[model samples]
Target: MSTDTLDLDDGTADRALLDARGLTLLVFTSQGCPNCRQAREALPDMNLNVDRIAWVDAGRSGGLVARYEVFHLPAMFVIRDGVYYGAVQASLAHWDISRQVALALDGYPAELP
Candidate 1:
């Protein structure tokens, strides 16, 4: 229950899990944001493991949001190997998210289906 740790559904002991994990997608969302709502809805069809992603509420996690320098809503960052890999904003499509994540993690182009 660290101050910087977020409340996760997985019951993970660590709150700073993203900074220590392999490939993690940190999605910054805000209430009443249309783009954020769209991103949430698209999550199910994105063809990615839910466990690798964390949907963070920007309002609730002000410090965490500021840590990432996320000034916009519906922003996502790919963190891997304890490094900030890359980021994408206002993504509404599954392919866009998947491609950005792949490019950040794999260092190559991702083909969409």
Candidate 2:
């Protein structure tokens, strides 16, 4: 449950939502990455749900960065139903990334009771 890494226990970003099927944005960030810092700052202002975002520190875990094939900071991967759904690469504006995230969430199927 460390804040610096993705919670991979049940493949859910938030452990409390392990049984909740929905879209998750696995955001990979690194130290000294300006773009990543910017994205982090803007994310709290976005319309995204708190549980839907996973802020992972890539610099702290090289294996994670390699596993996701991420070659840049502030990389975002969408996961739905415990599967890879989409990705938004680096070098893009925070607004653009937020838009992509919204689109991804729009496509997520509603969870069943």
Cα-based lDDT for every prediction: 0.60, 0.60
Q: Cα RMSDs of all predictions?
A: 8.3, 6.5
Off by over 4 Å in 1: 1-21, 49-51, 106-113
Lowest lDDT 10-mer window, candidate 1?
Answer: 1-10
Model 1, range 56-102, lDDT digits (tens) per residue? 87777766666667878888876664456667543577677767677
| Residue 18 C-alpha lDDT in model 1 | 35
Residue-level lDDT of model 2, residues 1-113, one tens digit each, is 11222334223334433343565667787769998888777665565542466677876766667767777778887666555555664345556766776676566443311
Clash number by candidate, in order: 0, 0
Best by lDDT: 1
* Candidate 1 structure lDDT: 0.60
Q: Which candidate gets the maximum TM-score versus the true structure?
A: 1
With a 3 Å backbone cut-off (N, CA, C), the pairs that clash in candidate 1 are none
Error of 1 at 100 (Å): 1.2
